[model samples]
Target: MLGIKHNQHTNLYARKCNMKKHLSALVLAVAMILSAISGVLAEDITTCTDSNGIVYQLSEDSSYLILKNAINTTGPLTVPSEIEYEGKLYTVKEIASKAFCGSTATTITLPSTLTYVGDMAFAYCPQLTKVSFGRSKVALGNRVFAGSPNLAGITNYSGVEKIGYGVFDGTEWLRTKSISTVDSAVYLGKVLVAYFGNASSFNISTSCTSIAPNAFNGNTTLTSIDLSNVKSVGSSAFEDCINLSSVTFGNSLVEIGSYAFDGCSSLGGEITLSDTCEKLGAFAFSKTSVETADLSKTKIESIGNGTFKNCDYLNSVILPESTKHIGNYSFQGDSFLSDINAQNVLTIGYDAFRDCSILSDKEYFENVESVLSGAFDGTIIYEDVNGSALVIGKTLYKTEETEINLAVADGVKSISPYAFYAAETAQLLALPTSLESIDEKAFISLSDGTIFVFTKNEQVYSDLESLTSGTIYVPEGNTIENENVSVGYITGITITKNPVKTEYTYNENFDPTGIEIEVNTVLNGKESSYNISQIGYEPSYTYNFSASPIVTVSYCGYETTVITSIKFTSVPGDVNRDKNVTSDDILLLRKYIAGLVSEKEVDLIASDIDGTIGVNSDDLLLLRKVVAGLVSLK
Candidate 1:
């Protein structure tokens, strides 16, 4: 019994030794993990002040450092290229926004590793006089040196790729440099910063490669500019230059920023874009009088919003084949604009061509994949025949009524984009055989219940199948199979040939003998024209002796007018129509010949007594002789 008890005690001691060893191993593992976590936390420190009292912060991914703030540092601060923190080195890549604002630094020297300077980095520095940029190109944020009253010099800025607005505003650098020479322009390296002079025909410096924003804004006296050496024009550079009529763009020109030439009302004639020009920003040429814009040589891919809006005299625009998108109101209110080449345009924005009264190019939207609302509104290509429907150059632009079945007029070659957008619940839509293309979004907003009845089988029917869930039916013999589908409506009429006998006596009936009227009707899904019998149809008009009367020819609820003359039967030498050649008529004729009486007051036909096609002194003499019965009234 004593030996067994000793064995049990030995086993318990052995189990206790194993548990102690496992606990020690766990403690060591946890300590190592904690040390690793603490190391990562140190590196993750978002912000820290360096030994020189300059604040620094980690970049978004903690891969680099950004110089955050040094406002407390006084004169001649030089930013280091790299900052060491927590035993690790990080490259200082950027300066945070407002980093040195309100500082008393006399000068700032940026390191070569810096890529960007945030907005207002050194702004409001009262004593700042100079900023030395790095060797590499740096993108500057807005108002970088604004309100720095003593700042007068900028060094190594030739590598700057972008400069935000008002960067040098309220600074000694801009003020002194702007008027330093007879040119009255400020040049920051190769960039033309600003022009404050009132020269009417100023030429840009030959050495300039770029122009800064608002460079020559609101210059009323600048009538012409020679930009033969410029490469880029910044936003609002020439805005509101009311008299800037001539501009010579060079081949090196690449970019024209937003509102660059906006409101230059006198900028007329052909504007030939440079072949290297790629970007044209929003409202670039809005409200101008440019007669023709030839962009075929440019590399522009899209036209921005309001780019050419309200250009009253813009007659033609030749877009490059590279163009894909047209933004909202791009060409709105161009009244005389008639021609455009946009065959490859993929998307058109809202009101892009709205109120372009005479724009009638049929193939402009052939390959367009998308079209926003009112793209072609108020154009002359479409006629407002009915309140809800329009016929645009052999295309049905839109139909809004759902109560009655819609019949597309015959000879309509296409259906415009979003033609049935407003008629979502429409029952039936009839299509003509003349359709060759259906534009994108033609059946948008249509419901499944809507039926499309085509007069003949067409490839467009297959295209429509992919666009909508509506039922399509092609009838036989150029007629709609469904009787409910209304067809054969009169779309329009034309006065092909006017009456041969236009002249008639006052109060005479309108003679329809020589009149030829061609009536246009949609019959059995086909456009048909026939000459209405001249004797069978009577025209409606009121006789006017002085002016030509408009004769209205109405047939099948469609009407068109023909202009014809109906004048009073003139009696020779009877200037006053009293049915006699008397002394009163001779006196009137004499007064007309003397120029005392106006042409309208006297009957010119009656005053021409010799039938010489005019009322002159010779006619008056003949009338006087007739009144005296000298040669007897012929």
Candidate 2:
């Protein structure tokens, strides 16, 4: 019985040892499972070394592999599109940010499946000369290839929609690629990205609608441009094109963006704008060599700041009737501009005409309403009133210093050329009605002082037409018919004679229109009335008459004049003539805002009653306020 008990105990001990061994095996399996699951859940990044000794990370959730970094290599390296790790394959989709930043690689090829490239991924890679994308649909982050000025070309198979700003900001070589695969030109959508041909002169394709910003920037070899189909020229499009001498603009072109041709110093000769051009952005022609710019045909309403600043060789500027405001520094540093015609300009910004050294004292202020300080500098200025007036070649060059008011002698028929050039003293000047002509750029820099004219003869209107600032007084029977005849600027001119009423009737009510009348007036008290139309002196009168106008004659000795008047005979706020202040007026206001019509199309005085002095969106809002009972039209 003792032997049987010992054998049973031994069997029990064997069973216990077998249970411990099973427990150990079970624990080992659980630990292995937990470790494998944790590796997938917590440590998802799988590191692998490529054949080229480049380290790449493959994440389980990632659809593609990422190139983390590369080992030092002497030659070009191409990244594989697919990476296999632990029995899984991941397509290389993106190059991680800063993956190859400042790399010394001479050339690199992106994978075919790459869709995204992080910022600065390969930036500052000085030796990187060629970058060829295998696929077309790749997106680049900001500055992805910035600071790599040595890049010869970036060949792509497809177009990228979202290109970050400054992606090629400092890539100077991209501007002068003399050889391209497609007509030596690169395009991004409908815009011309760059011209890589060696041709000095280029004609844009008809299919191109616009030129991309910096498209041809820093292209010094380009001598001329022919843009017959482009609608808009982007900002900095031709900046620093030092050799560009000629430009043939397209008929469909409308807007010239800021700095479009900022530094084209060789573009000399006559420059004229077509009638379709409506806007000229700031610094559009800054630092150019344009000799003469005639904008008479353009419909541009505003001259942007620095539009012609530093145009050292610019000699003449002809502003059109559509111009309203002259922005600050528009003509600053134009040393040679001697003549300027800004007939419809209302507001002159500060430094608009500053630093025009040789620009004569010929002022064209026929319609100038406001003149800011420093508009004219670097020109001759007449300071003291005490000394005798100095006349050079019939031009009053300078005057002696004096504190009292000044006056020209009665027989002084003309103000000398450039007289009172850049004068900025607060002193009055008296003029005789006998003064006939004043040279250009005269009275340009005058102070806010009064100018008294002691003559009833209305022929003197031509002499005072260019007086921008300073009040002027004329006879009671004469009137200065100009937009600058404001309350503070001009006074004492009146029309004592009653105007003859005339009318023109139409089948349907129409917008107010201007009428031209050929007046037969006798000059020098002679019965024979000369036709001045042959001499370009065609007087036109505008009237809202209900019937055909009847000719009215008047005799003024040297010249006879025909005059008539027709009034709208409507309330102040009735812009649309519906007899009510409604939304129609707002529509008209919007039309004016969109540059569809001018202030003369509507009631100018009433529209200006919004207290803004000009017809703009503010006046529209004020009229809307009146309609909403938020404010009064009065």
Candidate 3:
């Protein structure tokens, strides 16, 4: 009784594509040789019957889709590696896309000379019981037997390098009796399996380079293991291996993926990563019972959220200086984890280290900017955002922004998610270092959409609609994502925040507080201003004024007006110019203190670039630097 469910069974066979990129030229050469042996492997055809009583034919000569096109019947059919036709040898060279899809075939035997298998080739082959890769030099995929309902067995005799993606995607049979490395393969050391049956003991090798994802997804009985030479591990490689009490990595691997060890409850040991690895994908070491993992030499830039969920035994963690940021909720679910020390981290992502039961040690929260929602909801200490970490152009940006513009620090590697989100209308934004990723709803909600900044991570920008409804601009960079029109205006907005600046807005007729201002009227940015008191007599006229400046008048009882500022050089000899200096400066005239202003600055009060205390020639030069964009005094 076979039935199709909407959405559940849609396009199960859609991914039979064998881009075959990972397959080396030597493998192709081997296939060509085998084809040549078949006397032009283009003339032979294998005639077989499907379970639905339809006669089908596969021509091994010129086309790979020959048999797939004639499908009608369905059953557990084993297409032979070689079919004898007129006493001539014909190689089973190709398998078309979704050829055996939705068929009740319970077993499939790939021919020894099969050179190509199309994408989603056997998807929905519901009753598939076994899939064996023959002596054909090609590698087998983790997806080959995916979605096979009763697939209880799989074995590839070839010495290929990897288990491709989506292979064995939804098979029920797990818990290996024995899986070991054969010829050509150096050694298949840690093919970790999940508990499926009553198997008590298992075997492991010392030469395996990777552990397949979800290899032991539901195993409960497998308790202890030793892997000393394993190099690389894939995502969720040992996920849900419930009974895995203890395990360790071999000495050679560097990179680990998200959720590599997630759900392994009882593993307790001193686990450390090799110095050579660079990428620690989203949740690579999640949900394990390792007491203290050492990450001293890792060059990690971002720590993903939920990477350590449910790890109850973690009491301490030491992050290396090479780390720059930790993503949202990266350490949220660790119920027993207490302390984390990260000295060089710049921005803690949204809710990063959230709910960390005992997170008050001071080593990780130092020098941080833009803590997102719930970042310290239950932390033991109150840590403030680092005002100094807000930088632009490789130096801390001390000036406030009516808008965002990160023109220079192109190599800056972190963004505090929604650092400067504000209430005023902004016109421009600039993003550099090819942005990495944006968190959920990182942008502010607005009626009119605005552009988003960019770093270079592809996955982050692929589906940006999850952030907001406003239009966004994503600049093109060295590494680009989809380049799609569906994702708002993907254009690079140039930041021309040079010395030249101005702004204006029009109003209705007979405006009172300015110089002939009216609705729908515009003025140039370089030369613009308003004339105050033209409509009424005003008292404050003691300042440099620009011609035709824009005026803003609001009523809070009587109306008060605001206008644009004109650049003006300060009076040279005014020590207490605006009378801002209180009697406190007179009582502090001690010796030269480094934190305090110097005597030169005190002698020339007008030259103080910064308004704090004394002023001198250093202060004079600082004033010049501020105008020159080298120093800041705001």
**Winning model by lDDT:** 1
- Give the lDDT of residue 456 in candidate 3: 45
Tens digits of per-residue lDDT, candidate 3, 1-634, equal 1111113322231121112212333465776788899876543324533223333344644333233531332555555454322234345566666676667776666665665555567766766777766656544434555677677666664433344456555665432233332321122213333223334344545545566555555667767655555555667766777678777555566667677777777677666765655667666556777778677776666676666655667777777787777777777766567767766777665555666667666545545533555555455542332321243212222213334332323443334434444312223333444344444434444223343344445654653545433334443332223333223223321111211233322111222332321111112222222221222212222111222243333211122334444333333322333433323232222222243644433323343446555543455445445445565444
- The TM-scores, one per candidate, come to 0.56, 0.39, 0.44
Ordering by lDDT:
1, 2, 3
lDDT of 1 by residue, 1-634 (tens): 0011112343453345335435545765776688788874222336665434577788999898888989998888678776544446678889989999999999888888888899999999999999998777677777989999999888988777666678899998888877676788877666787888998998776778788889989999999989988888889999999999999998988989899999999999999988999999999999999999999999999999999999999989999999998999999999999988988787777789999998876577676655566878888654453546665445566666543255565566766677776665644455555566676677666655433344344557445554444434444333323333343444566888877787765445677666676545554467765454421333344433432366667543356887776565877776776778898987887887788987656666677777766678898777778878786655
Q: What order do candidates take by TM-score, descending?
A: 1, 3, 2
**True lDDT of residue 207, candidate 1:** 75
Instruction: List the candidate 1 regions with Cα displacement exceeding 4 Å.
Output: 1-75, 83-106, 384-397, 402-425, 428-634
Residue 602 miss distance in model 3 (angstroms): 23
Note each model's CA RMSD in angstroms: 24.0, 23.7, 17.3
Alpha-carbon lDDT, every model: 0.74, 0.63, 0.48
Model 3 spans with C-alpha error above 4 angstroms: 1-99, 103-120, 126-132, 136-143, 146-194, 197-203, 206-210, 218-222, 229-243, 254-257, 275-281, 297-305, 310-327, 333-349, 357-382, 385-634
195, model 2: CA deviation in Å?
A: 2.9
Which of candidates 1 and 3 is the stronger one according to lDDT?
Answer: 1
Give the clash total for candidate 1.
0
